[model samples]
Target chain A: MSDSDSPSAITWCAIIAATCLLLFLFQQILWLVVPFLLALALYYLLAPLNKKLVLSGLSPDFSAALLSGAFLLLSGAALLFIYPIAIAHASEWQIALLRYLEGGTRAIEGMIAMMQDKFVFLRDSDISNDARQNLMNFAEQFSDKHLGKVILTIAAWLPSILLAPIITYFLLKDGAQLRRFIGCTVPNAFFEKTLYLIYALDRTARLYFLGLIKVAAIDAAFLTIGLWLLGVPSALILGIISALLGWIPYIGPLMGLTLSIMVTATDFPGDMVLLYWVMGLFGVLRILDDFVFLPYIVGKSMHLHPLLTLLMFFVGEAIAGVAGLMLVIPILAMVMVLGETLEIILLDTRLRARHTYARNLHKRAVTRDLNIS
Target chain B: MLLNLTGKFQAFKGTETPQLTTMRGITLFSQVATNELRAIKGLLHRRTYIKDEIIFDEGEKGQAIYFIIDGKVLICKQGRPQDGAIAELGAGQCFGEMALIDNSPRMAQVRAAEDCTLDVLFREDFLGLIETHSRIASKLSLELARMMGERLRQTINSYVL
Candidate 1:
């Protein structure tokens, strides 16, 4: 039997169904959804600073406006500075990408040769030469077919992504008013409970997102320092990208490992020793993340089982692809909270009876002065 | 006729509703200025209860204090009959103030003795006030402490006599 506090199977199904539906809808409007999600993250990140400002006697509206304006100015200046430099070096960067791809292909060939040498049956079969040819072809095809599309997609995202700060400013300034509006709309019989639910949902999202930022910061620091010490080129950029990718759970860390391996192989083609060290570094990072950082930082915020998390990852990917992967956990966590709260409210016979009584009371009062007789 | 219409128009435009007027006389808000009271009004929620309706059950976790704006309410111990109500409170009086300090199970149940309207101030909003408007919060806190002390003295006197 399920614990009393735990949601029933029907509630769980509803939660999952709601999550999938929302994910599908989000995938359709990904441009808007992406910026909105970013704004939510920014809101949580800056909320503490806003709270401090409020405590220091600034009105929420003034504090939010100040923070949003400062963020816009800082980001705009950085973009202006970087835009010219990025354009000037665009062709050089493309060539550098191809070189890295070629280096990665060679590293694979080297591994194949070493494996074939160790296994006499493989050496006799000409597997190394065949694999080398296949790797070279695949690398060339990827650069030719996918590179331009990737750049175009990023360009398209830039304008919509700028909406994040504006949305965050509104959220900070009017969040309480929005909450008050919602409370006012609910029937008085359910007012307090509804307010408590809103408070709980806000707290859950805030803690989980803030915890994620802390975990990412820790991962980036560890990887950057490790890669720099090991002489990996562009170590800081690689570390940050990998740390971000790590947000997607099992698949994310694996993708990060693949990226680091490719970069290390490209930068130091002949060094199997360094390649092994890079692999070992990621392996340790994976272990530490699974055991230490996640549990300590994120803790019970998700309150989801590991098996359920893994299953949802596949379901999310199947429904919305990469966007699904990114959106699923947060959506699921929120739906879970909603479903559980609704279940408790629906099952509370006393509360339901009280609501009915109040409704009838209101009806009688309204009719008392009528002249139906 | 022209003057009466203008007076009615002014009443509609004014900030002081009947409930706000009742709130102004509440002992807990005695020292608060009109501007500060308006700010506090934003943090209060209005609820109405029918006669004999249970507002809250004893042992339920308390999250807010309720001040009657009209009509009356009965404060009673759970498992006691209607005739055994411990206190009958009228307009301008408040109950559940202890919840502002802690989230303890309510010490007693409350029911409407007649059709009533109340303004509720939640603990979360109160704490937020403490953060942003400490001066107003301090005055309210002092009144709350004084009220509690007065009640304690009355209880001790009853026992001693």
Candidate 2:
């Protein structure tokens, strides 16, 4: 058996403590970690382009610079053209939201009035009074607390956004040297396995990020065309929002659909037929996403069980909110791959023999010391 | 067949001038073109091992084929010095070629018989090359099959005698 297969209570305690310590350190440096992870994702997406360029006779530095230049140009174009239209649509949506809320309040009041007229007992009931008060309190708290905090967080993250492109460029430029440096650190016994694991992780992350970009683009295009056909205002903006939110897996697409429905309902208030059509469109798209796009594009890289996935989703949500929910699956998948690779290395007879030999040598030394004393 | 084997051994023995030239002399890579060899050079990892240093232990997972650049290597079933040694390969010879076909445990322990310089070709890189350059992969694969077949025929003849 491998030395790691059996551990005393003290060993278990030490392991747990070390894990907790690492987690605490991770939490403290999360600001750095978040941007680094984003940069790594970007690196994975852009590295293949750089490699292709280099393979075609361009120098590595030049290839990386060219890709970075292209990205900057694209971002500049989006800021110049798309940003203004999105901003204008956002303002329009804000106004529409207030109008919808006002209409909703009036409808609720009318329902309460009719209920009071029909049932004299409910007019004097504390339950009805409490429900109304609770709804008002919840809405006030959401606006005052959640919305402000979200805005503040985004403002804080603005500086970190600049780090991503710079990190991605360096990763593209010196990726081979960096990989070799890491490989050098691995023990000779586990070198091949470690290299295999690193390659597998790189492949998985690259495939996932590229697949996500493709899926997002397809989703955005499909939604924009469908919304335009349904005569929805600001279809482009709504489509972009849907595409961005679609990163969050099960919860994100639903949130995107609800937001689209709300905006559609506000623009064409009391049009029940139009609302039904929008809902139908989202349902059809959801089916397509689940059955076709996810299976075909994303492939079966994540071999996680559905129950474990849901549990992790809830745990992730509890720990880091929406970001956690989006990152959890990929992180878990990587961990699974790392664990399996390590298990193979650990189970190898030579590695186990080495461990056994070391343990025996230590034991013999300890016994000799005791006898000498 | 004996004369042909002797002639090939003599060729290897005579051409120990440079590692790259000797690599071409090896039967497994004899058919590979110069441009293909240049491409394959990028995947080769060169390492120097001192005398008596263990290259790899028996029953350990093997993922690379090693080409002898200089000096000699001992292939033994057990780790102890000269215990059950099957071969003492010199410069221009290669070992662990079976690893290129499958990621199974090493059948024999490999140790440096003298100070040795070797080029290692890992299976992952080999697989990657197969995906990108099918022509090179096919040529190498064909040569490897022929080498294996020759060895199998020799082993069967020895057993019959």
Candidate 3:
């Protein structure tokens, strides 16, 4: 009469079905959900600092307040000192980019002609011409159709972005109490497992976010140094963009390389020598990043298989575009942890016994009600 | 038919409620400061079980240590549930303390011999306290070690005699 024997396959199927339904509902409300999720990420990033301050003899409230104040001051400093410089650079970059695009088209045409001349096979082939035309069309379409819409969408999301800090502040201040309230709702047999799952998720998210920041900083430094040594214009800005893009995993590094190559192609124009050198530098740095820095600094925290990660990336992109691509890995990792933990608890004899007991009691009440009616 | 079997078992939820003061009497937490105990108390899960209810089964993974706040609990070896009652614990005594040190399957089953109230300290919460309050962690670990030593001495003495 073991409890584990009583819960049939139907129960497990029901649980999975319910989870999928809930996820579908969540996707429908993603606009509201995204801000809270961002706040939760911010809370995980900052909570440890608050805990350290408290451990050093400060009250939790005071620590949270101090950290929040410092964060606001830092944001203010960036706005005052960095925004003006960035805007000025953006205007220059816009003019430079337009000039580069015009020059780039001529460069591509010349390269195609040279390739066809050098390879007699290509001279007779129409494929080279078709490929060149496709590339030009893609660039033209992206610049004309997509870029403005992307900027407008970002402007639209500005109000929701403001809610993140306020949500994060309350989370940091009352995180434990909120956790306790959630914990209390769990049945006695599952209480410990729930606590363990929460702790594991928190640790995993904290390590992942911290590891990402470290990886980005290292990438930015390496790119900046490499570009500066190569005498590329606006090395700092390009390096920063590359580092930010690096967060997107496999596709991101390729995009960064392409951007660097375009800038190199523009600056050096017909200098294949300098373009090859820049490509070589980016290739070497990418190898170092993937093989050495990412493995050591990130340290397999997500434990996701590379193939599965790629699949998730594609699926996320299809579902919610770029934001989904960025968020899917962490969310999937968390869900995996939660599912495994819940499965263990659900299969536990004690929990099953409790459930069986409750179900029997419910049956008795239902039968009694039917008898009375 | 499962319902019939469960219906035959008498059920009375234990009335005892665990308080911070009760933690002072439990040997594992005795040396912890009052303020620290209050914090620890918040982490404990208080639960009441009916008589004949299975608290936990043998061979199941343990995640928490339980202190008996009221009534009695019977600990039995696997495969001899009816004949073997290895130990019976009452109020102030704790069982499953080894779970706090490491995650392992329970060596024995624990069932409520009578309606019982228990205060459970989960391993993760205990580790969390150890991170935040090492002093309290050290005190509890020392007490746990002392208790193990006493149990070992008693077992050896019984064998020698």
**Candidate topping TM-score:** 1
Off by over 4 Å in 2: A1-27, A80-155, A225-237, A287-292, A338-349, A352-373, B1-48, B57-60, B67-71, B78-83, B88-94, B103-105, B117-119, B132-161
Q: What TM-score does candidate 2 get on C-alpha atoms?
A: 0.71
Predicted structure 3: lDDT: 0.73
lDDT by residue for model 2 (A155-211), tens: 688667656777787888777657566666765446566776777667777678778
Model 3 ranges off by over 4 Å: A1-30, A80-90, A99-118, A124-148, A193-200, A233-236, A285-305, A341-350, A357-373, B1-52, B67-74, B78-83, B86-93, B112-119, B125-136
Among all windows of 10 consecutive residues in model 3 chain B, the one with the lowest summed lDDT is B8-17
Worst 10 residues of 3 chain A by lDDT: A1-10
Looking at candidate 3, what is the lDDT of residue A363? 64
DockQ winner among the candidates? 1
lDDT of 1 by residue, A90-124 (tens): 88987887787788777878888888878888878
| Native contacts recovered, each model | 0.08, 0.02, 0.08
Runs with alpha carbons beyond 4 Å of true place in candidate 1 = A1-3, A120-131, B1-53, B67-72, B78-81, B88-94, B97-104, B113-150
Candidate 2 interface RMS: 10.3
Fnat value of model 3:
0.08
Q: Rank the candidates by TM-score, best first.
A: 1, 3, 2
